[model samples]
Target: MPNGPTRYDTVLLGSPVWNVLRPPMIMSTFTEALDFRGKTVIPITTRAMSGLGTAERDYTASCPGATLAEGLAVRGEEVSKAEAEVQTWLKRIGLPPR
Candidate 1:
């Protein structure tokens, strides 16, 4: 966090889904302060059931001028089973989907 997102073209932001499928309030504090005008922001989440919840919309609001990529959500009990999804996401983000 000290280095911040200044050097990167993408950011992966995440938190446990809480309170009717929202990230904790503090995430906004972290996000709202930054300028992400040309950055790609990805939301990742570990949720019991909300599955990324309102994160896409939340990030859209908090991080201004950022391209919000499709995010990854792994259920709390299913982390071990989500590797393929994670890899696919990473690949898709890194390389054009074909």
Candidate 2:
């Protein structure tokens, strides 16, 4: 794992929903690499048709002791038009667009 801060006040986890699951890499990163205790976790997922699936749930499980915020799911085809939506979500989570 890359060396960096082990603790954070906020964490943004983005993943592509695949087959009703988060990608394996994301799972590994959260479950095996990071420590999220007491942090605010925001799960964001993009899906073609599978929807958000269990991305949020899985992330919550992986980051035990963390505070999970409302998650955001964007349709893959709508990504290009989702800037406003993304900004809104960011704002909702207390991280206004910069």
Candidate 3:
């Protein structure tokens, strides 16, 4: 957490382009393992049809106090087409559209 006013109350946990392009590259960030104290830290990923994969379980175990939810697992190739769906999902989850 930073000292000043935070830009996000909901942290969209996502991997970089390189990670998305690679396979079997499941990894976590520093904040992924912290106790978020019930704050929303939504995980979003681009996968090859395998929905949610192991991320939900992994995140739940890592961030004990955070309200981890079922993440979006859109196919990598369909990302552009799925933008609106993703934005809607985010909004439904209380996050602002990008």
| Best candidate (score: TM-score) | 1
What's each prediction's clash count? 0, 0, 0
lDDT of 1 by residue, 1-98 (tens): 55358898988897889965899989888898778778999999999878899999989998888999989888878888987888898897783434
- Residues 1-98, model 2: lDDT tens digits: 24322555877777788775665565646554666777787877888776667876777777788788888889988999999998898888778696
Model 3 TM-score, all chains together: 0.69
Give the Å error, residue 90, model 1.
1.5
* Descending-TM-score candidate ranking: 1, 2, 3
lDDT rank, highest first?
1, 2, 3
RMSD of 2: 2.4
**lDDT (CA) per prediction:** 0.86, 0.74, 0.62
Best model per lDDT: 1
Question: Where does candidate 1 stray beyond 4 Å?
Answer: 1-4, 95-98
Q: After superposition, how far is residue 2 of candidate 1 from its true place, in Å?
A: 8.2
Write down the worst ten-residue block by lDDT for model 3. 16-25
Off by over 4 Å in 2: 1-7
